[model samples]
Target: MHQADMKLCLVLLILLFVTLPAQADNAWQAWREGKALLLMRHTLAPGSGDPAGFVLEDCSTQRNLNNEGQQQAKRWGKLLRQQHNGEITVYSSQWCRCLDTARLMDLTTPTPLPVLNSFFAGRGDGDKQTQALMQQFAIAQTAQPTVLVTHQVNFTALTGIFPRSGEAAILALPLTQPATVLARINTP
Candidate 1:
């Protein structure tokens, strides 16, 4: 290879190694700080929420996390296990996708909170409940880090940001400060 081409290849290799590890370190640091609140937007499920004829009680009537989503959730759980040594509380929306994803984590049996449900439905009560949940979370005194698994709309409503699937947003609560986009984990 030409000297210039070799130099370019070296630069590319250096960037690939340096940049990727830096991102991973940042993510791990965020997890360590406990100032980070990992808010996930469920896993891969092409559509958002359920269709017009959806039924809340029956998951079959809803647009749930598919096989890929399940795997992604499991992968996320593994990552958390490897990264965080501290105790982490896991919460999820009542929806099937959130519930399934939370379960797949296998880290903790998630507590189902209605407040974590989607705000996309534009339900006034849901919004009120969500706000209440946030307030509670903000005030609670827990030593362990907490993770909330909900929909993009709900995550956005809480932190004023939309999180992609399998992506986690870290929020500093109590003051309700701006949240940081941690990492987007692809389980596939």
Candidate 2:
């Protein structure tokens, strides 16, 4: 091969290595700047749908997080702290699993926000719930980077993307425009 060709190849390789990390840093910067919101699905909870006669006030009646989920939540908290320098505010659904996942993250104490509650299980409240969340997000105060720990139903309603439990979508919020997804982050 020609020396010039080899030199060009080396330059391309260097750019490839540098460009990828720069892009990743930009994503994190947007998140840290509060220009983006992290919408996260609650961590693993075994079983589907609640059992018969489930009650909102009774956690025993609801499906709770499994052991793996607990660990996953904790890991997410650690990662966020490391990434953001310990500045994170988490809002979570009132459901047991959502609350548990948020708490396990070990960030600031999770606030139970009704808007983040799941409308799944044939509740038929999807539209109402989604509107409430949108309104709340629009007015939310941005003192710190925030994460909302909710369910798959809410994630789908907001972003039209069905996220797995424990996954997060980073979205950019503009006051006059609809939120746009900047990236999707998954726990490693």
Candidate 3:
């Protein structure tokens, strides 16, 4: 084989290795059946931590979803609409990125939850925020599935599963001290 062809094949292999499909250990089915919670990390916001002078109420002050992220969130909406026809309850962090992602999902109007906000970079107390989130979920249980759109830090604190941009983890109900992660799905 030619050197260029071999290089092309190597690149393809790397891409394949990195983009893993969500491992559904009944989690997908559970989510579709409205038995699990859907916790999502905000989609492809281009930058890292919030920029300086970050303000919770100000979109320009925070790191936010890019056009690609908007499109990705819409895809998630389409996927969710196809998967389950039952009612859904959506919650999102006050962050622009998270709120935008949840809104784009089109599942429902996302109610902002401060407990779901990112505690990364000393922005909030991770332990306290995580605990509050657990408590909130415990009290907010419903017959329909609940989706929480948040940041990587908040979700990781809850499930110990660091998420990719636009990733969703299927977590078992009654969110406990040690959350039961049923499955994970990256946006289609």
Residue-wise C-alpha lDDT for candidate 2, range 89-128, written one tens digit per residue: 8999888999999999898889899888888877548888
Q: Candidate 1 local accuracy as lDDT? A: 0.74
Instruction: Give the per-residue lDDT of model 1 (tens digit) for 84-177.
Output: 8667789898888889999999888899988887767664365576567667767423466778888877766666766678777655544153
- Window of ten residues with lowest summed lDDT in model 1: 172-181
lDDT (C-alpha, whole model) for all candidates:
0.74, 0.81, 0.85
TM-score of each: 0.75, 0.83, 0.83
Candidates sorted by TM-score, descending order? Answer: 3, 2, 1
Superposition-based RMSD of candidate 1 using all C-alpha atoms, in angstroms: 4.3
User: Candidate 1, which segments miss by more than 4 Å at Cα?
Assistant: 1-30, 124-127, 175-188
Ranking by lDDT: 3, 2, 1
Model 1 vs. true fold: TM: 0.75
Worst 10 residues of 2 by lDDT: 172-181
